[model samples]
Target: MEEQTIFHIINNMDKVTNNLIVQWNKVFEEDLGVSHILVLGHLKVHGKSRPSDIAKILGLTPPTLTYLSEKLVQKNLAKRLVDDSDRRIIHLGITDKGIEVVQRANQKGVELRKRLFEQLTKEERKQLLTIYEKLNKSL
Candidate 1:
């Protein structure tokens, strides 16, 4: 691809992402921020996970994860679990409330995506999906 095309694609992708985030902030009524929701979503998908592992997977520092997890625990959305065999090891797990929140967040995300993509034809949406998948694989 030419340099101009590449720059245009990158710029538009950033604009689209920022727009979605702005819209999400307007529509999402939760007190939690994106990082907190990311941690909860990770727990929802992987069940109980060590703080270190979660931090690594999420590209966050251990202390940052601790800060985010603390908020979740305080909100009763998540809990800390001590390993039975290893008391030194701590894991975080999502609570029932956390699951509910994740579901609601996902629903909001789906609705936002629908609204944003509604302007495009179905074929265009499919093409965009394919392009994104390819780009993700490259990463």
Candidate 2:
């Protein structure tokens, strides 16, 4: 691809992502922030994980992770635990309440996504999913 074509595609992708985020925000208006929801989602998916590992996975700085974690902990959505074997290491996990919240959020997101993707044909959706998986694996 030409540099111009790549740049255009990148710009278009950014717009699409931003638009979806805006829609998601509307659906999750009661939540704290997308970052906190994202953190909870990660913990929900992978179970308990160290703060450093979660930060690395989420492409966040330590301070950013700390801020999000603190907020979640205070909200009673997640808990921070010290490693049983390594006292200094901190692990973060979603609480049962957090699971319920994540589940409801996911349900709402799925409904929004269904409406959002209604314009796409099934074949297009399949192709998009394949593209997303390929891109995800490349990272």
Candidate 3:
């Protein structure tokens, strides 16, 4: 039998991972985009942060993240504000509405993850998780 290459495994995993993310996006009916949800979720987890910090954490550039932040602001989901001490610093924080969206989105995301992984046995889940962690660290 022929041995499958490492790239083959990575490609296959990327396909499934991306597809699952796409499907989860379909679960949202609100004005919240995936970036908005993720950004809000990060804010909720880490408290307030500068826009540049958020960009760094998410691996997004300033322009791209600025656009997302603007969209969230336009939708009343997030706010970009000046830093209290450093007026030049632009910070981001989720509004009550943003928190609500993150909560709902989190629920939906959890549901989809459960739907995808619940079918696998404990050992299979552990193996997939171990491999996924390794891949993430390798990247």
Candidate 4:
């Protein structure tokens, strides 16, 4: 609860996240950016989804999602679907290639995390998981 403690926690969290991203990028071997991979992952999990919904869920602006989706569509990793009942409604769906990309990215991510967490003892890992879950639930 002290100011210094909060600052240290936040600083360490940022460093951990940056390190993970940097390491992931090195092993990912994909030309896509994190935002693009996140969009693909979302579509893989959620099936077809409205751009607005994806934007809200991902904490991105509608225009930013639009730009990201445009790149995805161009790469054939995703497609636009027009609602049958309402032509005004549009959804984004991931393709087979997108699924493959997501799977590869996930594997690399898991491997990277495992290597990073291997530094901790089993009990420390459990404590970290519990603490992270508690912090996430607060959000």
Q: Score each candidate by Cα lDDT.
A: 0.94, 0.88, 0.85, 0.95
lDDT of 4 by residue, 9-108 (tens): 9999999999999999998987777899999999999999999999999999999999999999998999999999999999999999999988999999
- Evaluate residue 99 in candidate 1 and report its C-alpha lDDT on the 0 to 100 scale: 97
- Model 1, residue 76: distance off in Å is 0.4
Those runs of model 2 whose alpha carbons end farther than 4 Å from true positions after fitting are 121-139
**Which sections of candidate 4 miss by over 4 Å?**
none
Q: Candidate 3 — which pairs collide? A: none
Report lDDT (Cα) of residue 39, candidate 4: 98
Clashes of each: 0, 0, 0, 0
- Model 3, total clashes: 0
- In model 2, how large is the Cα lDDT of residue 1? 61
Candidate 1 local lDDT, residue 47: 99
| Global lDDT of model 2 | 0.88
| Candidate 3 positional error at 9, Å | 1.6
In model 4, the Cα lDDT at residue 60 comes to 99
Pairs clashing in candidate 4?
Answer: none
* Tens-digit lDDT track of model 1 for 1-139: 6999999988998999888887887888988887888999999999999999999999999999999999999999999999999999999999999999988988898999898899999999999999989989999
Weakest 10 consecutive residues of candidate 4 by summed lDDT: 27-36
Q: Once model 2 is optimally superposed onto the true structure by TM-score, how far is the C-alpha of residue 117 displaced, in angstroms?
A: 1.6
